[model samples]
Target: MSENVAPTASAPRSLHGWSTEFRATFTLAWPLVIAQVAQNALQASDVIMMGWLGPEALAAGALASSFLMPFFLFAAGVVGAVAPLTAQARGARDIKAIRRIVRQGFWAAILLAALLLPVVLQIRTVFSWIGQDPALAARAEEYIQIAVLMLFPALGVIVLRSFLSSFEATRVILVVTIGGVVVNAFGNYLLMFGNFGMPRLELRGAGIVIVLTNIFMLAAMLAYVLRHRRFRRFNVLIRFWKPDWPRFRELFHIGVPMGLTVLAEVGLFTAATMLMGRLGTDEVAAHAIALQCASLAFMVPLGLGVAATVRVGIAYGRQDREGVRKAGWTSFALGTGFMAVSALCFLLFGPAIVTIFLDPGVPENRHALALAASFLAIAGIFQLVDGAQVVAAHSLRGLSDTKIPMLMAIFGYWLVGLPIAYVMGFVFDWRGVGIWTGLACGLAFVAVLLVGRFAMRERLGLLDRIRL
Candidate 1:
């Protein structure tokens, strides 16, 4: 087996000069941003298609998807540990090390998916335990059960994509995602509407489409990686066919806490979605639309955050502390600015955005629209902070300081954010806006702390402290 070697280190400097690092950052970040956007679009399509099936279907899909979302978060975080490692290796031009990391990451993702199976299998029971209208609960359970089958493929895709991403090979993800979205949409149309002699499965049909789409995406990514000359010659394709226990252990060391960190953050939103179910289907439906809108808007910052991770990772790999610091702050500034524009758009046309997924004429629909609009309005208020915190987290991850951000997510979301949301939304009956207001507070806290952490680390020359 060919070993992956690390890239050679380059001297670090400020961004003042016409630097290779600045050019490299942009070169890598743009394609990554595009790929992230495509993936988000695919996810958004799931919500949109289900929404077209009616409010009940929308509510069921939202509940089911959100319930399963934390698992994906965990999986993504685990896979994400590969990127920084790969990026550092790439910076040092260690093709052998990169190949080894990719192989190990693949196996780690498979194991992580397996470990999550039992938890996913319990999703139905967990939802019931949370207490819901029996009918909606049943629909949610059915959708979730089928969706569970997708865990393997979905996790595989994350691992493969992250590894490839570190090499600045992002176009593969974009191609696969675009194709997957098309497949998902077509399948959803056929399965949901009983088109072209297909059996109509309603909510279950939507889940089936999602599963198939994920499988297709996994296959596509694998094919691309195997066929690509860069990866093929580097021996990543052949190496991935074998197991590497030690490398897997290293991946787990980085991945597990990263998973836990993501779980803590995403789990909060999952909990919020469950809480919405208790407020009636209208509330749940409204929340789903608002969530979708917010999620779509979030793609901008999310893409930037992903880009920031690569930038920071590359800089860290070269041991350029100054470059790492600048990359992070630059991405944060860019993300914040982008989200500010989105927030303004959402504020001025919040109702119109909700209308994309719902009709406002029907009585119940009107109520859903009103609630969703309220939620979006509040969500818009914190878009900038939300972007900042996510970018900050990714930047820190690039620095390989995953633990602190994990703890911060726990404190900010659970101790501070959720309680406030509960008081304002449920206790005080401030409704959707109150819930979002709490989310904003939590996000703001995360933003401040993460950025502060990065600043402190830079000032203390912490990058040198962690260099391998």
Candidate 2:
């Protein structure tokens, strides 16, 4: 295992000037931000290609993705517990604990991938149970059967990526992920279009590309971490087969709620997708385009949220109250500020953006294209809150405080958001637009509760529980 090493001088501190804090946060954040975009691009590239196969392919891709993601994100969130655990260990300068926590994180990833495999392979059944069109469900099943295999490599990548982020060596993360995006695009082009004598398997081809891209990313990240002088000494694989029962339990302790927290949020969106599906193929496809655009923009805050986890976890481990406060709020401010710009971009350029995903010149796509533009306009409304909620939820995770936030997310998303969506979308006969409005409200609701929880951390003793 790596030895206890003090944070480098460049690490953020409570005593630093405001300008220093901003610079420190930005320096830590920019690579992660780009990496998140590139990570999403792996799928965005697939979406663009699926668009070429026409609306049916695009809608089926969206259906498969929505069905797959709630499970994928839940499992990844469990493995993602590594970031806060490793960061706090880094903060307290505990070499042994960091190695142990990370080892268990890997174990958790492998176990989770195995457990979820059978469940996600049932995508077609779930779609049928939920009353989706038989043809769409069957096409989507073709993608699911292959794409679900990515879970193993994807979760492994998250484990390693969390470790890399803790040490602030994120440039390689950005490089590896961007490389995955490029490779995935190339693979999709060859496999999906029969280029270079390859078979045109369409959605199945896209699924193969997804799995291969994730495996390449996992392999690349592993190679770098193993060879990098700064990380190699950790020897995380030294006892890869040994079981540390307590540490394993601790991973589930923090990870399950984190997983459910992600599930609640993703479930809301997935449910909305189902509702759109009920409305018709064009509704679902348009929802996919607009949602993809919003999700791409969302990668910014999601990156900042990752950075906040490390920064806040470090301070929490050191028992530096002021350090934790500065780190959390600074990240929150930066996230919301960036979203302000994105909101305007969505409002102003939504039609232009939608055009990139679907040709405005196509007669067949005109209705879906117009609907996507309208959905983007609504997506613009929730940008700030969407950004705010992620940063706040992650900041609390840094405190090793997740259970309450999990409940809060459930309340806001399920009890609050889904009910609204049903009423507005179905009861009100508003269809897709009404469904999206509920999503915006749910995000906004979670943002308030989480940020307030952070603001009250001291008063609530949320900051007093550190025992690493």
Which candidate has the highest TM-score of all?
2
For candidate 2, what is the TM-score? Answer: 0.88
**CA lDDT of each candidate?**
0.79, 0.89
Q: Model 2 over residues 288-335: C-alpha lDDT tens digits? A: 999988888898899899899999898888766667878899999999
Which residues of candidate 1, in runs, are more than 4 Å off? Answer: 1-27, 47-63, 127-146, 189-208, 239-243, 274-286, 355-371, 426-429, 459-461, 465-468
Any idea what lDDT model 1 has?
A: 0.79
Candidate 1 lDDT over residue span 47-66, tens digit each: 88888888987888888887
Per-candidate clashes, comma-separated: 15, 1
- Runs in model 2 with CA error above 4 Å? 1-15, 50-62, 131-142, 192-205, 277-286, 348-374, 426-433, 466-468
Q: Lowest summed lDDT over 10 consecutive residues: which window, candidate 1? A: 1-10
